[model samples]
Target: MELEEIFNEYILKSEQLIITKRSMNDIAQNEIKNLNQKKEKEQDITGNKNSTHSMDFFFIQDVKSGETTRYKNIRSTVDEKIKQIVLQKNKQYQWILSESFEIFREFLIKSYAYLGYKDKNIWPLKDYGSIILSEIENKDYSFFLEQTKTKRDVPESILNIFRNTFPEYKKLETCNKLDVNLNLEINLIEHFRHIIVHCGGKTDEKHKLIEKIIKKSGLWNNGKYDSKHYDFISSFFRLKESNDIILLEIESNNQDGFPNKYYDVLSDLMNSLNSVAYLIVNEIKTIVK
Candidate 1:
């Protein structure tokens, strides 16, 4: 299978999106894990003989150079490997060939055209090195996933994606720095838009509070919020006329605190909240097939 055929006919690369090589790789890692996990889930759901042994293939959780994360199938056929390789290479291809690399922080709003996604911008360079790369000390590329604003669905799955992407950021900080630095108001909360969309804006009380906050605020284009309500927060940022500002403001009244107790090692990409969106999308696609 070719990259063009798979991504173009299948993957829905959202506009307002451009991923660094590391970020894109993180997504691919997460996607693979998600697929395997789904296979496991199905096995469990059916209670089959294969349940006696654990799957030899599991998502790579370490955030170091993902060289060790390559697929090593014990008995996969040619067709299966082709599909896997496409997913694998596509992840790296998006970042290595992102459109935003050239003009500093200028957002390139066009798909790779190499793969499949239409007129969607690749990840911006300034946002990566100047912004995320600087904050992270010398780590790997995946470390920058902390900067991503992903949708909500499988919490475990999304967390996995972030964990995988974190190291990539750590690694890239070695040789690059943003030419023009700007303060980015990073809002790491998943509740900002995802929760409101998951349950219709007016479904219940918790959701209503979300709807109320979003309505009173000036974020909405007219009266409508996101389609799924879990759109990436940055996917809808308002840029100033001067092209010098990235407005990322949060308006949550409730006191949100991080215990920092449960925080330990990060999970693999399949468990990532960010990466799970693609996984679910893939899963659904498989179902449709």
Candidate 2:
């Protein structure tokens, strides 16, 4: 299919996914609010504010032995239950944002291959230094090459491929709406994605790549927080250094943590995806014409 068609389809599918997620979030929030109100009314009527009489409960089962253990009957207040729900929702948001980045990466790989098929000159430059290229099955000039490798998940490395491929390729325009450094923000988002997926939502102190990403992305620069780190970093992460290891503290439980109603990370992901894909698609179109 044409790059334009692919872009359109991606946009449509992404919009649908986001709409469904938001609708579900709204429903859950409303139900929680209603439940809280109902509990309050019941408490007023019964004059038992400290009532766990109508709280939630669940049991844990051992799959190996088919043994059901009555895990402490979580007799908690409505507020506490709401907090748990919010934590789960934040986890969901993080997954969605990270998955979007992966999807965009795939789209970019496709765009690169398509451009190369249209013109072999779109391949890596001499300075790229002997990249081992392999032709993708069923695609004429789709070179599945080094930049898309698992170890090379850095956003700058992928973007650098495009810059090297296209003589006229320029830096992505600053996202005026978000008013953050797109380059740095994209790198940070990818770094967060790595932490969530590989390190179970914690920073890997031993990973050299993590340290490099932190330093270059300005999360920690020159042994301290960068001057503009808070501008974009505060939206998705809380940073700290522990024993010379950068620790990323995700602010999930706090309602005011996201500041944009938990859409900040996803918004940045969408913007980066759209900006990169559109530029690649437009450039490819121009080349083919």
Candidate 3:
């Protein structure tokens, strides 16, 4: 397939997965309408100094006090930064989708082998180019949305939507490993996803926290997050017998008894950070909102 066809298909597939969450879908619509250039905008906070547009756009009300925000809007610099970050994230998201498609393609090719197809016809299943592009109804083409009937993907889209809507989240420090809490949280999320998808659905406390966050926020509620890798976490870190006692398991996943498998866990001591990331994020929102 042509390069344009490949890239376009990737964009289409990514958009489909992204549209599962209304929050993200809405942001995409609004942002696409507002911006022309993909590069970050040069923020002009002075233009909206009277808070006219800000007041109209964002609805932040203090439920108990019967009051809303006094300021019209947050800083304009923040808004532009948010747009920039979102653009960056969109580019990164494409890479991840393409890479994962490669893996999924290999699995499909293996299926052909079961039917006695030779490698000449199967050809390693490399070209996701045209197959992904052939489209039908917009609603019918959704991957997980069609698969899962009762739920939606919200939490998975939350961080992304937040980045798109909130400029502060977009202005993260890049390459500064020591101070990047969000980066660390992302790593934790990836590990959790991998474990759950690759291993059987088992979990310890950490895995449970991931599950709770996803459920509490009504994100990815189709039950895909409950992976088998959770079992590894529970088996190694969580106390199977004790109901009340909560403790962090060791850091290194290099324990002697752990079943020799493809994935491993933590670097040193599986130190419990003594908190839930989603909850912590919510608490901060509570104060600010």
Best by lDDT: 2
Global CA lDDT computed for model 2: 0.59
How big is the positional error of residue 39 in model 3, measured in Å on the Cα after superposition? 66
Worst 10 residues of 3 by lDDT: 267-276
Local lDDT at 18 for model 1: 33
A best-first ranking of the candidates according to their lDDT comes to 2, 3, 1
lDDT of 3 by residue, 219-275 (tens): 334777544433433443344543221212234566677663322122111111112
lDDT of 2 by residue, 204-288 (tens): 4534454565576546756766545543444344334321112212335566555523334455466666666676777667668
Best prediction by TM-score: 2
Off by over 4 Å in 2: 48-50, 53-71, 125-155, 165-169, 174-178, 204-214, 218-226, 238-265
| TM-score, candidate number 1 | 0.18
Cα miss at 175, model 1 (Å)?
37
For 1-120, candidate 1 gives per-residue lDDT tens digits of 223333333322322233344455466557666656656676779754233323246455456764556455355533354356544454343222222121111111111111112111
Write down the lDDT of every candidate, Cα atoms only: 0.32, 0.59, 0.36
Rank ordering of all candidates by TM-score, starting from the highest: 2, 3, 1
TM-score of 2: 0.71
